[model samples]
Target chain A: MQNAEKKCAVKKCAMEKSSVTEKVFMSLTGLFLCLFLVVHLGGNLLLFKQDGGAAFNAYSHFMETSWIIRVIEIFLLLFFLTHIFMAIKLTIKNKQARPVSYAVNKASENSSWFSRNMEITGGVIFIFLCVHLYNFMFSQRFFHHYPSMYAAVRTVFQNPWYVLFYVICLSWVGFHLIHGVQSSFQSLGLRHPIFTPWIKKLGVLFAALIFLGFLSLPVYFFFSRTSRRNVQSAISHQLKIENGFKRGASQ
Target chain B: MKFTLKVWRQKNAQEQGSFVTYEVFGISEDMSFLEMLDVLNEDLTLKGEEPVAFAHDCREGICGTCGLFINGRAHGPLTGTTTCQLHIRHFKDGETITIEPWRAKAFPVIKDLVVDRSAFDRILQAGGFVSVNVGSAPEANGILVPKKNADEAFDTAACIGCGACVAACKNASAILFVSAKVSHLSLLPQGKPERRTRVLNMVKTMDEEGFGNCTNTGACEVECPKGITLASIARLRREYCKAKIKG
Candidate 1:
């Protein structure tokens, strides 16, 4: 006999269909954010130049003044929001799926600890993002004028607690990235024997590079008193230029 | 060999279960795992006590009915062996074996070690079939399948609905089981007609059955008796994406 047909409503079908859709959404947004992180790290490397912050301040200035950068910043914020939203949604769905737990869980033998705890790492990174945005992007208390991104960054890194926090957060970001990149590729159905191992290696390398870039900035500024003094002088010089521009405009 | 068994003992589905330790003595090393349990049951019955209840069909490993969580590894410590196929010699003498039923919200323990795996059957019923006209066996030469694809299909088709993957997974995910079914059929031409709807329906049923989402831990793959690969799950992912985008 032919199998009897079962009818489910279109709405129900759509609801069921969205888990795969959610995965696709998370994978794409997460990969795009990875690209954003690479670009961010590249820009952040300017913090290390010995030009007394001129290169970094100029780069920050261009980023603030360019219309394209401003538009991309908005899009970046949207991407972050969507990525976090999908993560939370999928996490809740997964938790609900397994209402009962095993009595003796020996899960570490089968999977990496980092892979199992993506939500925790993602949570830490989100908290760090909020503090980072407050210190550099949204709050004007740290630096009174535009193009003071260098001063704000240097000032924040000077505090020992902030440095420690930044290092810890970057470590978490590294953990999240190492699992996320490969996972997103698999979620997108980009699995292959030859390329899978290489992709995993590349993920680790990218994570290490980003980790080093973020970590070095804090470590370098925290210990190098001379560099801190130089950054102070550069900030004063930039403030002088801002005052001059204001005075010229008023005149 | 002598062993202390800490078996999860529950009277029924409603009763809360607890581990009860039993001392099993004079166990033979040559006995299969189930045979050892058979000896334990025989002793319990002779003592006028209720014997430990577990499921088993074929004494051989093919039936997939026998399963247990021995010492935190599915089907004991040996890789790619079912519970029935496991021999007592592998387990050290005088060791305390912590045996528990497959713990998941979907697979509720019925008595002792036996769980209601009907959830899996429900998932299979959702979309595990291909629509074909009722007829005698069709000639095998009507459709041409590459040797590699045929081999791969046969490999995936070895899954026996054992529920070991669910028991082994940290999240209790049935993705391996469902994906194995999907991969085995979708690899051949006969299964092409319903591939899209099949995956979609099967996945939806899997979710509805309260099986956990796959976290790609590879636990199920490591614990699978048939050595089902994670590649099938990847194929499931590919099929799912294709169905959602195109179908």
Candidate 2:
């Protein structure tokens, strides 16, 4: 039998692929998602306008109708899927590289807790996405006469459990973003002594903004609904006492 | 000072390893970490037991041959120092220091606290040199080199090929080591001719050697004996991207 030839040869050698291929993919897709978050936040913030759901409903309707937005949404979904896939692949590969674990791993000292637990934070965000899609996208796709986007959001946030869940998930998103934004730049070979510090600072600020912005929606809805209910009950109680006193006086 | 040590012992690559504890007495606080080990080995030799095998070429820090995972840190608790340069003074008396081999699939344990680092050599072989022909030495100022470039290249060239970076890395990635080589050569004019090919082949070899990918955690920079910065890895990425685009 003839001996097998080397798979890579001088004549048209298959390009040398590094394990960092997945890392690069994850970084780019992750940054794309970050941009998507900013656009998403801008749209979601319309729920706060008190103009009754008209503006938010109109915005949601426009987003649904525009072909360009539909295309962008598809790209957004693709980026999310790719980022998740690459993250899992790289994580598993990294684990296998060190089979026999360190006897006494002081790994936490070497890096930040968030940087080390990116996979856990990512997993939390993934679970949040599933619930979010089910609540919002499911209504948009399935219900022919769907409620206004504002009503749908308010209804979801009215549940204390759901609001709490959202707050928790948004916190994890902040954790993931804090490390991920700077990490993407590092992975992309854009590190510079002068600019890296600024980039890191900017990354932290950006993550904080996302956390606070998203958390505000659920928190605001929850508190506003509860306060309105409280005011209504107090007014009704006062009316009951007045009605009772008037009936007694007449008798 | 008296201290206890828990050193990892494996007869060969095929066997599983475990820690073996030993006690040493009357060691001076000023003795280097390796000297303490030598004292322990001497005692074991006198007792007719096989001496613990470890790697150390230059007792001073520069040779990069010596490496140990002391007390969970790569080159002991002291930052920016090699195992050979780490003094017993940094360690307290009666403390039990755990010494282990560089634990990575790419760096298999050869024998007690020693790992086969030939994977590094193979990576170097793949593309760690300039293509200049051997002949009479070129004139000192034949080629004008920018001072800033020369300084940066020198800083990058200081990487001693110690596997501490791999040991310290969460992923056991060799990106730092390969990046050092790539940055040092690509910055110089003599290495300009084959910079693209050099990065391609070296990275390819690094991947093939069963080393993991860098996650940019920056542990390698913190644990590096030579204080090699993460900038080299950044340059490696830039070089790789440029090469891929050119291709």
Candidate 3:
């Protein structure tokens, strides 16, 4: 019998595909988020220096006044929202894929616990974004229009419980960023031989600086009693000034 | 050594399951992991307790039949070693071990620790073979292959088709495994003619098999029993790009 011809010249999608294609999409989106982070951190660090927060806030106000910023702000929201949603979706896909349990629980013996549990860390950050926005964004963006903007800001930070909440949320963000910063490079095809070591170090340093800088503010407000002390001093100083004014008026 | 093995017991692909702990008594420290399991199975057979199921063959680490998540690790605690080659010496006398099937979407559980890795074979059928005239085995050594090409091809060829990479991957990506196979054939003169078509087809097959994406975490290489390097993944990328650009 004559053998059938090698009729099919090329193998098409009829066969199974590799996992690379979806990963590439995830990697590309992850890289875009990384770029957004650098910009976001730069904006937030504006609060680092003296009178920095007010200047930054006014700058944000200035941004709101600009048409370009309006466009970029929309893009920023899309970026964060898309990244977070994709992360959740990807995690589900990952979890569903594994089919077996090992006879020996030996793999985690060598790797870092942080790397093993990145999804949990990332989930915590997702919850944190909600709380952060509830107090900060809801107040500044939505609640500010009604009244008592300063009181909202002060009371949120001034109350010990609220201060504690902020601290916990920021810490979660810190953990998320730590895993994200390192893993993002791998996603982006940045596995250069000589550059990888340096990339890891840079990732660690960036994650640490961002975490520490954000953490310092809430902790300072919580511990110092600075706002309460200033109020007491202001009351005494006001009493003296009022007495002087009364005497002068009487004379 | 008297130890408790907390093995995952699933009756079939359709059923949900949990860990079933069994006591394996008087295991020799020198016996390979599979041998230790053999002792336990022998006991279960005499006692008529539906024998615990597991997959293994070619006790010598060459065949890739032995694969499982051992205590949260692919294979056991040993790096660059297959389960069949893992000796009991790695664990202490009274250690309790957790054993389960390779956890990934592409590899479905057949029964207990036996997973259906036929997805891997499907990936192979895609773009895995070089397009050449049939049965006309080209002149032996007709095409001159460079020494470096031969060496690199051999390195890629060293893969034993093990599913450890899938087990180790957080995203359950088969990039390392696919890339190794792709690179092995693509490196030499005999396989060069169909390189582009091979990558496209193989990659497509990989996705069709329901495998997740590679996060490029390099965990697969670190845990690879054959030491299939992540360089293979890079090579795969380079090949895929070349194929996309040219073909």
Index of the highest-lDDT prediction: 2
**What CAPRI class is candidate 3?**
acceptable
Q: Is the docking of candidate 1 incorrect, acceptable, medium or high quality?
A: acceptable
Candidate 2 residues lying further than 4 Å off, grouped into runs, are A1-16, A143-146
lDDT of 1 by residue, B51-170 (tens): 999999997889889989888888888889999999999989999988888887788999999999999899889778887877898886988999999999999999998898998886
* Order of models, best TM-score first: 2, 1, 3
lDDT measured at residue A13 in model 3 versus the true structure, 0 to 100: 31
TM match of model 1 to true structure: 0.89
Estimate candidate 3's alpha-carbon lDDT, on a 0 to 1 scale. 0.74
TM-score, predicted candidate 2 vs. hidden true structure: 0.95
- What's the true lDDT of residue B86 in model 1? 94
Summarize candidate 1's per-residue lDDT along A1-251 as a digit string, tens digits.
Answer: 13223223322454464455667778899999999988988999998898889998888878878999989989998999999988887678777655655666666766788778889999999999999888787764345644477777777877989999999999999999888888888777788989988999998898888898889988988878667678999999999999999999999
Q: lDDT (CA) for every model shown?
A: 0.85, 0.88, 0.74
Find the 10 residues in a row with the least total lDDT in model 2 chain A: A2-11
Candidate 2 local lDDT, A1-251, one digit each (tens): 12123223321233545665567788899999999899999998998998998998999989978999989989998999999988887888888888887787677667788888899999999999999988887776667335677778888889999998999999999999999999999889999999999999999999999999988999999999999999999999999999999999999
Q: Which residue pairs clash within candidate 1? A: none
**Model number with the top TM-score:** 2
Q: What digit string (tens of lDDT, one per residue) describes model 2 on residues B203-229?
A: 888888888778888889999988788
